[model samples]
Target: MKALLLAGGLGTRLRPLTENLPKPMAPVGNRPWLEHLLLHLKREGIDEFVIAVKHYPEIIQNHLGDGSRFGVQIEYAIEQSLLGTAGAIKNAESLLSDRFLVVNADIIHEVSILPLVEYHIQHKGLVTIGLTEVEDPSHYGVVQQTDNGEIVRFVEKPKQDEAPSRRINAGIYVMEKEALQWIPKNKAVSIEKETFPLLIEKNVGVFGKIINGYWMDMGTNERYRKVHWDLLDRKCSFPLKEKEQGNGIWVGKDVQIGSGVLFLPPVLIGDQVHIGERSVIGPYAVIGDGCTIGKHVRCSETILWDDCKVHDSAQLSNCIFGYDLELGASHILYQAVMNRTAGVLQG
Candidate 1:
């Protein structure tokens, strides 16, 4: 089945980081965060994808290209204006055929999606939304379903006291082509606010498929860091290259380690990285590709993206540094997170 990835949001919560790059391109672990999503979908036999882009479209276009590297065929639907979730799908109507799956680019989940697709096909419902039980349903669009899994009510961000169920929308859906008829073209429309509710109003068939698994919305610095650690900690399942035992540490190809370095593990270093001497790394640190670390540095619980440079004696803990950034000597960056261009968080 073809998939539609919603990647147009401004990523306001991630600030400083999304200030330059799109949220989908934000670095997570060793590669672009969106790569993980694409890879996940690829494994599910959904190799054809259409990404809807608005913010910094060129950057996403340049990075993903035709998606050949990941063994998928990718097409882009550029929105000149900000189109809401349903609107974006409506805009890409010409490319979509039959039933399709829609996913949010910023969401990371390791749930088995095969069942959800099968459920949608079996019910032949107008739409089937993936639901997950959350402790706090007030912050999300809660779904109230019948015993047979048919959605009975659609509540969009109801108050905690007013919510009928704790099951919230997972921002993933399977919809028949006819569902697109409910959404208008060339206008801002939200599936949660406009389309889904309208379907319910018209007494159309809508169902919910609940899944229990590791899921996170990487829309903030803390969650972004947590997601990376979750992957490293084996809390979430994603396709990633594993490192085997090596001298003092496990480093990827083309790595440059300088002299006088004090290394520690459970650390994973990516390709084309440079590390300076007298530096202490890890006890859970992930350095991305093409990074340059200067002398006498200390990093723990930190992640650095490609081409990032840490100057002499800089200390980074519980932080994420974006691409091509340079840190000054003795720069102590804690809980610092960035998006595209360099912007430091004091906290």
Candidate 2:
């Protein structure tokens, strides 16, 4: 089966980071967020992919190319005009001729898709959507299903009291090719608001499969930070190298460690990083590639992206520093904004 990846959104919520890089290109650990999604999907035996591109399309195209590196054939569908979720899929209809999977590029989940595909085939449903229960359902498109798993209602971001169920849409679906007929071409349409409801009204079969696993929507700074922490803490599963238990801090290849360093473990230092001595690092920290760390710095529960430079005596806690930014000496940052750029002396 093929897959349609929704990559056209502007990602306005993840500003500063999304100011330059597309949401899909934003680094989750050391790699782009979309990289993890693609790797996961590829492992599931779904190789052919069609990515809908809009904002910073070239960056994704350049990085992923033809998907040969991941053993998949990738095609690009550029959206000249803005298309909503359903419209985006319709725009790529020519390429997705058979049963296919649809996923929001910004969502990260460990749930398996194979079962959902099997269920769709067995029931001969037009669409099979993945659903998961969330504590607070105010912000999500909620789904209400029958006892036998057929969806009875589809509501998009309903008021708390108007919600029929706490089972929110997981933004993952296995769609039949014929579902595209319900969506008009060259027009903006939402599956939740427009297409899915129409199907339910016509007695079409739309099934929901509930899943239990690690899932996250990395659309905000806070959630983005938490996603990284989850990966580092092994709360979620991903293909990342594990560090061997040892004394002092372990640094990766091409790393530059400066003098007077006080290092602590469970910390991961990526390739080509520069660390200044007398600086206390880690306990729970992840420093990305090519970062420059200054002297006497104290950091915990912080992640610095590639090429970020933190000067001497700087103290950072529970913060995320984006790429190519510079932090001056003695600066203290606590729960502040430092989105993707550099040269800040204070938090």
Candidate 3:
């Protein structure tokens, strides 16, 4: 099935991180966050994709060119101006199939799409939104559905006391082409605020499919960090190449471990990493490719991006270092986040 992947959003919530890269491009588990979504969809047999992008469009185009690397055919639609969710899909209407899937690029989930498609077909609905139950529905689009699975209302970001349901929209949908005509041409529109409400008004069949599995929108640093820990904890599953060294510690090619170095489990170290003597890493650390760590350095619950260097005796905890960042000797960084673009947040 053809899937419209929304890849264009200025992730304001993920400041320093998104300051230079798109939200979908943020690094998670040693690869681009969006790669996880693409691979997940591909595993479900969705081969053709229409990626709608705006911010840093070329980065996405260059990285996933033709989608051949990931075993999928990809076509990109660049938005000249800021177009809301439904508007972006409407812009790519020509590339869409008679019936297709729409997914938000910033979300990570493992729910299968096949059943949702079957459900949509069975109900003869114009759209079938994937729904997931969450502990807190106040920050999401609360979905109210009938016992038969037909969506009766959508409340976007309602207050906790005002929420009608704990089930929220998971940002994955199956939409029939006939529904596209209802959306006006070349205009900014929100599917949640405009299209879906209009569909309800016209009595168009719109249903919700509740999916049970891991799902998260990594639009903030806290969420981003939580996802890594989640993957390590086996709360969510995604493919990675690093081999598990032992005790849940995964390492990549050409890694050098020095004497007296302590490795706590659930740590992932990428290729060509060098750790010096008496250094401590993990419990939940992710060290990226080409990193150089000095003697007596301590890292815990931290993420070091590619080629980062930590000087001797430096201590780090709950830190995130962007690509090529260098920590000075004996530096003590705690609850800090730094990016290559010179954005720094220190606790």
Candidate 4:
């Protein structure tokens, strides 16, 4: 089956981090966020993907490169201008099969697509939206459905008092190609605001599948960090490497740990990482590939991307150090995301 990955959002919420990098490219577990989504779909027996992209499309193309290395065929539908959710799918219409799965790029989820697809096929619905109950429905696209799973209404970001149901759109769907005809071509259109409402008004079949699994829309810095922390804390059952050594720390190949160093659990030390003597790392830290840490440096709840260097006596807590960043001696950071080019580096 083919899947259309809606990756066209400009990511206005995740600023600075999304300045050069697209939101879908945000790092989670030492890999691009979209990579996780793609691999997850790949494991579910979907091989072909059509990625609808607009902002920073080249970066995705450069990294994924036809998706051959990942054992999938990738095709991109680049929108020259901004198109809303439904419009982006409309832009990629020709590439989609008669029926295809659509998923949002920013979500970190573990719901199985096979069951959703099977249900859609059996019912022959125009659209089957994957729904998950959220504690707060005011910020999401809420849906009202019958007890039998037929969707009756969709409220996009309803007020607290006006919300009809806690089941919100999980940003995953099984959509028939015929549904694309309802969306106008070359225009910004929201499926929630335009197409789905029209479908219901026209008496088209639209259903909801209340999927039971981990789901989080990592659209904010807090939620983004929370996704990583949740995975590290074992709050979700997403596939990730397990600890092979002391204290639930997942260390990579050729990692060097100096004497007298301290490491807390749930830390992931990437390939070829070097830590100096008496350094303290982790309690939810991710040291990316080829990083070098100086003596007595401390890192907790931090993420150091590939090839970064930290000088002696440096301390970091609740921070993210981007690729190739260099930390001067005695530098300290708390609750900030820093990259080498962002000018937050302390000399």
The best candidate in terms of TM-score: 3
Ranking 3 against 4 by lDDT, winner = 3
Model 1 per-residue lDDT tens digits across residues 1-347: 79999999999998877887889888766877788889888887889999999999999989999999889999999998998999999988888869899998988877677899889989878899998888888888888888989988878788989998999888889988988888988999988877888898887789998976788888878888888778777788675553545542557887778887766876778888889888999877888888888888899999888778777788898887777777777667778776545443222
- Measured with C-alpha atoms, the lDDT of residue 255 in candidate 1 is 78
Candidate 4 lDDT by residue in tens digits, 256-307: 8999999888788888889999999888888888899999998998888788
For candidate 4, the 10 contiguous residues with the lowest summed lDDT are 238-247
Put down candidate 2 lDDT per residue, 52-148, tens digits, no spaces: 9988899999999999988899999999888899999999999995899999998878878888888899888899888889888889888888888
lDDT of 2: 0.83
Clashing pairs in 1: 17-338, 17-339, 260-278
- Candidate 1 versus truth, CA RMSD in Å, comes to 2.5
Question: Model 1 Cα displacement at 264 (Å)?
Answer: 3.7
Model 4 bad stretches (over 4 Å): 241-243
Candidate 4 CA-lDDT value? 0.86
TM-score of each: 0.92, 0.93, 0.96, 0.95
Q: Please identify model 1 stretches exceeding 4 Å from their true place.
A: 158-162, 246-250, 343-347
Off by over 4 Å in 3: 343-347
Candidate 4 residue-pair clash tally: 0
**Worst ten in a row by lDDT for model 1:** 338-347
User: How good is model 4 by TM-score?
Assistant: 0.95
